[model samples]
Target chain A: MAVLTFLLRFLPFLLFGRKERPSPVLDSLNKLLPSAIIAVLVVYCLKDMNFRRIDNFVPELIAVAVVALLHLWRRNNLISIGGGAVVYMLLVQLVF
Target chain B: MKAELRYAVRQTLPVMIGYLFFGTAFGLMLQNIGYNFLWAMLASLVIYAGSMQFVLVSLLAGAFNLPAVILMTLTINSRHFFYGLPFLKKFREMGKAYLYMVFSLTDETYALLCSVWIPDHLDGKKVRFFIALFNHLYWITGSTLGALGGALLNIDLKGIEFTMTALFIVIFIEQWISATKITRVPAVVGLLCGLVLRLILGPDRFILPALIVTVTILLVLRPSLDRRSGEKEEEGSSVPSKR
Candidate 1:
């Protein structure tokens, strides 16, 4: 299983490394893919979201809103993360 | 080299916190499932991918089907393939250091590599290597500690995993705001595609399909986006400042 995992990771380098330069298409995709992937990761993080229950839904909503707004205000990754997490912990533990 | 190591440590500090909690959770889960710290350490060292490692604990305790494990591993880690694309040139340039980079390109490590700026005098190659190595070590330490005494920590960790989620949301917002030179099409397309897929496929199966969808959309729209943002590239807006 470990070997398979390693191979899946290594395959891209193997395919693109030993050859001609990456096509312009690949270059454009490379430039554009990071943000897209970051978005995917955000959705991935919220994957378990169950909105059917108000109690379960409110904390996640509040925490995410806190993260987005805090980041927009300060543009500091640390503050947004730390503050949002604290709010989330509090909500889940005490409020909900 | 000392300076480079310090920078690497600084870059990896947030990861240390996230991994410590997430990995400790992994260790705690393993212990709950009757595995020792030794197994936790080995998995963290070998399997390495955080989400997959958590899933592996359940797999290990339940079954011994090698084929099933391999298939599951591939599906869970398919996002890793795209992580290598942006690093293709750097990996080739790093020569011997390339293998370690490949081994350590987890999601958080890749985010750091993609966005963090190496200091002017420091070696970019070495900084990248150390960041990867340091993050890997943090993960290993977290899992080992969690396995060793996770139950004794006695803190409610239910929502602590939000650290990772908050971290990513913060990065996404930063990218959205920072990528002024490029059209924001990619970010919007990615966000929408992810949401649609998550709704259609659910979270467990949406990632790979979302990746494919995003790539296809970008490829089809690249020419127009290039035309729109192409002029800004020479203005140095293409390179957003370090986060």
Candidate 2:
């Protein structure tokens, strides 16, 4: 799977972009294989998306949003990702 | 350092936004399923891939079988099949962490990898390395927080799994807009294959098959793609090459 992912991710560069690959066959193939196997796995997940699942999925969405905003504010300091996660925990877990 | 970091962050801003939503959604959903913050954190930090982690929660909640888990993991992460193929040597040069880096690789990070043109300049290496590291760190943090979110807020999460889909669309748009020439073929192939696989394999098992078909075709046709690209490069540059 990872082998497939490696190929998919790097194929663009192999096909269209510039970068002299030492071994396009082995390197590119090995790089993207993960995503391919992942593609198969996640599809099953889409089928079972019920209210129960969605309800749980909500807070995660909120957390992700907070992190994103923090990244923008911090201009990608990465500290924001950490801080935002913690803040999200407090708001969701403690405050409310 | 300040300027570079800013640009680095700016470069990652879109992904950060994407990751936040999905990561948080993942946390909430997983926690809702029955795992605690520790489990969630472990998955996020170790497994690190958003889609797979989300699916994993359900697996853990229900029947955490080894075969199923292995298969599901493979299917969900099939997108990684070819990520480093062309850049194997580059990654190989990355030394020991190469395997771990590959382990941590996710779709969003992959998207970032696609956009950034790693130049041959002196600072280029640092920039590319940081780019990969920063993206990984962001995801880890997001996942840990999400696990925390699940632990703390026992509320209804509601429609958050859409986070992954939403992010996919955003990256799709960015790549679609920026792409020119040689990119069109794979895009069309991937889409058509994905759609077809969805129909044949049904929604629950389409992504992996689609990826399989796409990769096989690409590999077989690699020489042709390479040739066409070489011709195009000839028209644009005055460089001599020997690979």
Candidate 3:
């Protein structure tokens, strides 16, 4: 499993060497992909969102808002994440 | 060298926070499933991918089929292949540290390494090396600690996984804000495509297909997108290239 994980991570580097620049198309894709991937990942994290229960919705919204607003306000990764997670834990444990 | 290592350690502080929680969760889960601390440490050291390691707990509990395990590993880690694209040049120049970089390229480390700024006095290679090394150590230490004492700690951690989610949300916002108009296209497309696929295919099956569709959309939109964003490409470089 480890070897497989390493190979998957290392394949692109192995395929594209240091001496050569990737083609123009790939170069463009390289720039484009990070934003796309990160966006997709956000959705991936929220993939299990359950909309049937209005009760379940409030905490998620509040937690996500806390995370976004805290990040915007502080721009400190730790503050934003730690704040969000604490609020989320409190909500899920006590309120919701 | 000490200063550079300190800088690396400081930069990885957020990841250290996330990894400890994540690794502890993994350790506790593995312990629940009848694994020992040695097993958790082994998995953390070897199959160090965070999400995949979590998935691995269940896989280990299930019937051991090698082919099934290999396929599962590939699918879970397919996103990693794209990560190395931006780092290809830099990794190739890292001397002996190149292999370690490749070996430890977890999601959090990749984000940190991508955005790391090397001071003029510090060696860039060493900074990157230490960042990767420190994050790796944190992960191993967290999992080992969790395995050794997770049951004793025994606090409710229901929504703690939100740490990872929150991290991703911040990263997405950063990308969205920094992205150029044309560059934002892919980000929007990814979110829309992923949502639609998730609705249609349901959550579990959406990711791979969503990724494929997003890439295809980007390819089709490349010419116009490139023309619009062309000038800013050099200015707003996505990944810091080899210097």
Candidate 4:
């Protein structure tokens, strides 16, 4: 697992290390892919939700909503994540 | 060097807090699953990727399946492949520390490196190295402490895993808020692809397919995207300095 993870990190440099300039296609990807991949990660984190049950999904939805709204208001990482996680813990521990 | 170190520390303070909490949570989880502090230290020291390390805990607890481990590592850490792209030229300039730089480019470190403003008097490379090193040290310390805490102090943290999800959402919002016109396309593409694939393929198998599809679509749309961004570059608004 460690070797594979390192190899993935090393792959880009190995491919483009010697090139004087990356191709237009590669450059475009460099410019565009970061935000896209990050958005995908957000979705990936929520993949296990079984929407058929309200209890299983409601807490997550409320928590995510809190994270988003708090982030938008304060624009602070610590506040957004910390606030959302606390709300989640409360909901899971007591409400649902 | 002193000035650079001080600046790096100040810049990485937020990451320090985040890593400490997140790492402790990871340590607590691993310990709960019967792994000792040694394992937590080793994983944090080597893997260095926060989310992947969490996944690693589960993998280690389960019956060892090499193929499953390989695939999970590839997909989970694949984002690191892109993280290195913008830094390739800069990292290459760092000489022997280049390998270490690549290995330590976790999401928080990458974001800091991309967005932080180094002072004009300080060497950018040195500051970057310090930032990376400090972040890694915090993670190692946090996880080791968490593992020890788990062994010594029993506490209920039932919903603590939600931190991982919350972190991702924070990152997604950061990216979205900072995205320019040309970059917004891929963000939308990723979300739609991820959601569609998740609904169709189910959660367990959706990520890889979503990534492949997103990449293919982006590649096909590259020309127009390139042209749009090029125009923005001409207007001198290319890179937005984000915090």
TM-score (chain A only) for the predictions, listed in order: 0.92, 0.42, 0.84, 0.90
lDDT tens per residue, model 1, A1-96: 667777778988988867668878778888898888888888888888888887777999999999999988898878888899999999999999
iRMSD, per candidate, in listed order: 1.1, 8.8, 1.5, 2.3
Model 4, B105-142: lDDT tens digits are 88778767766667799999999999999999999998
**In candidate 1 chain B, what residue range of length 10 has the lowest lDDT sum?**
B234-243
DockQ for all models: 0.80, 0.10, 0.75, 0.63
Candidate 4 structure lDDT? 0.84
Of the candidates shown, which would achieve the greatest TM-score relative to the real structure?
1
What's model 1's TM-score?
0.93
Q: Candidate 2 chain B: minimum summed lDDT over ten consecutive residues — where?
A: B161-170
Compared with the true structure, the alpha-carbon lDDT of candidate 1 equals 0.87
Model 1 misplaced stretches (Cα beyond 4 Å): B231-243
Fnat, 2 decimals, each candidate: 0.78, 0.08, 0.83, 0.77
Tens-digit lDDT track for model 1 on B118-216?
778999999999999999999999999999998899777778888888878877887877777465778888899999999999868999999999999
lDDT of 2 by residue, B99-118 (tens): 55555456656555555644
The single-chain TM-score for chain B of candidate 3 is: 0.85
Backbone clash tally (model 1): 0
**lDDT (0-100) at residue B240 of candidate 1?**
60
Per-residue alpha-carbon lDDT of model 3 for A1-96, expressed as tens digits?
Answer: 899999988888777754476788888887888778777877888888889976576888898999999988988878888899899889888887
Question: Which tens-of-lDDT digit does each residue in A1-96 have in candidate 2?
Answer: 233434444454455334453456644444333333233333433334333565445555565566556554553333554554465455545544
